[model samples]
Target: MSERTYHHGDLRRAVLTAALDVIRTDGPSALSLRDLARRAGVSHAAPAHHFKDRSGLLTAIATEGYDLLAATLADAPDLRERGVHYVRFAVGHPAHFQVMFQPDLYRPDDPELLAAKARATEELRAGVADRTPAEDAGLMGIAAWSIAHGFATLLLSHNLDRPVGDRDAEEVFRALTGVTFRTQPAGSRVGDDTMQE
Candidate 1:
């Protein structure tokens, strides 16, 4: 293979992007730094320079996942929306979601990962704070997370009974939560913003 070079910090981003694509297509177990370098068109040693080993690469992915999740949740207007956003994030970033939860795959004790996880946890907890007492917020947050996470996992694995392409995830989530969707005009579709409950 022809050797390639990256300018400045582009190498790290390229490797991470390639890693995500590999993980998304074949799961994290399929990830190889050498293969990642080839996918990124970089020197064989390039990925190792940014991520020392497999675990280090996984740790970086997990850290990035938590931070993204936190930001996604923070953008929502309320707990319900946050829960919906969580599922959306999981589905959209399946590789990240898969890696973030499987603690054995990465160095969970890494400080940056810990901090990012804390931020995500805080965002989740904050979503439930207004609805529950301080002592119960944690439990409620977990409940909300469980619902969203389970739904996303089932959806991702094609375990859900419905036709995924025909339905809006947000609509299904709202229906599961006992909230009915408001009617839309003729020719309206699942994701046209009119399907929101």
Candidate 2:
């Protein structure tokens, strides 16, 4: 797809997708507007016009990530299910997941960024509404998000560094989450004895 073939919205979307592809393959530090333009088959200036600078592009990506995460978590039936969805989203979109948490990489005060973040937080909170007292919702949200985020981070970094016998990483993760949330373990306790390096 050449620049001429791209309309307004299409061009922006194409550029973003190209950036995502670059991040997925080479990591975010390897991204550049010029490289994204090359990948999108657009002029180098095209991405600059839309995103202004690296921070602007990252802000857009981060906001889009939050929106996507919010949508995915919304489909879950409860807090635990939402936690699963959160990890799945992070594992699937490691590019976005990496960028979304690095506030210094983008305009954290940007209205779009703030709104998207709020929506994602609200969705996460709703999942645990009945389980948490109203006054403690914020802390519970933080704890829940932390657990999911930590698990996803470990998974992505290959830091589990352990053998899981016959179980896959996802199965072990579900078991760990079950223990954290005080739910019945999907199989047995996912301790060092059950799955260790």
Candidate 3:
């Protein structure tokens, strides 16, 4: 069968989507602009019209990832659920997750990237707004991010396969979040009431 043709307006998205697939299967180090163009069935320079270079394409992918994460967080009911979804997204979309946080590899300052990052941060903060105190908001946000990010990192690095029930990542995340909140210091910004048993 012949390769499908992407219309002009959608070629950029198609290229990015194909690039993500490449990264997911082959790792970041294996990504190449020419390869992505080939996979997308477009001219080698087609991606340049939308993304000036490899960094530009990577930045666009990261921006798209952030936007997706922000939407997932927004759909969650509470901070805990939001955190769970965040971790889930990371594990489920390893390629996007890998690129989104690597500032050195992508141009974080790119307009699309900056906006998406800001929106995602806002979404997380909004999820915690009602449940956490003003002073604790920042800490709570960072803590939630850390919990998910750390868990994802651990799982990705294969360090989470210990005898603790050979716990699945989601279970480990929930357990860690529970334990951390329960053992928080008295003066800790996050109150015990916010934690689920």
Candidate 4:
């Protein structure tokens, strides 16, 4: 592979990092390969060489986000912890979180993206494992993911009317999850807390 190819390690990471910064500051719709290239101090064509196009870039971001999500959820002690982890992941990595769920912005057919998403799904499911009966395990997993995703999205969008003064979203999420954990049958709900661990 040429130095310009993605396997170059540092360059690709630099570009991705720059892309994340762009997304965080101006939102995903504002992201452009040209802007990312400039931010990374690479040639205008560099990002294209790695990501192919804007969709490819977003796909790569989503893929990375999924892997991170899986890792974040892997060690949660319980369903409540999982929910806290999920919320924290979203708030901590808002830029990647913003693009990961937007199918219209990324290539869903990408192999890496598919694999990453599968891993994330598996991690989420593991949280509810053995807690619910096998027959309803799938439904429990879905419920857990739905609640965590909904809460995280609402928090990120500022749709949650709660005052967050001097406190991060993760703090609010942990409290909310601690109480909300009972809403499910002791087997559902995932949360992400950046402030904790």
Predictions in order: lDDT: 0.85, 0.83, 0.80, 0.83
Best by lDDT: 1
Checking candidate 2 for backbone clashes, the offending pairs are: none
Candidate 1 lDDT (Cα, whole model)? 0.85
- State candidate 3's TM-score: 0.81
lDDT (10s digit) by residue, model 3, range 151-187: 7877776565552345576776777678777866677
Instruction: State the TM-score for model 1.
Output: 0.85
Which parts of model 2 are misplaced by more than 4 Å?
A: 1-9, 161-170, 183-190, 193-196
The lowest-lDDT stretch of 10 consecutive residues in candidate 1 is 188-197
Clash pairs for candidate 3: none
- Work out how many backbone clashes candidate 1 has: 0
Ranked by lDDT from best down, the candidates are 1, 2, 4, 3
TM-score of 2: 0.85
Q: Model 3 segments beyond 4 Å from truth?
A: 1-9, 163-168, 183-197
Q: What is the clash count for each candidate, in the order shown?
A: 0, 0, 0, 14
Report how far off residue 151 is in candidate 3 (Å).
Answer: 0.4
Residue-wise C-alpha lDDT for candidate 4, range 29-87, written one tens digit per residue? 89988888877777788888778999988999999999999999997888778988998
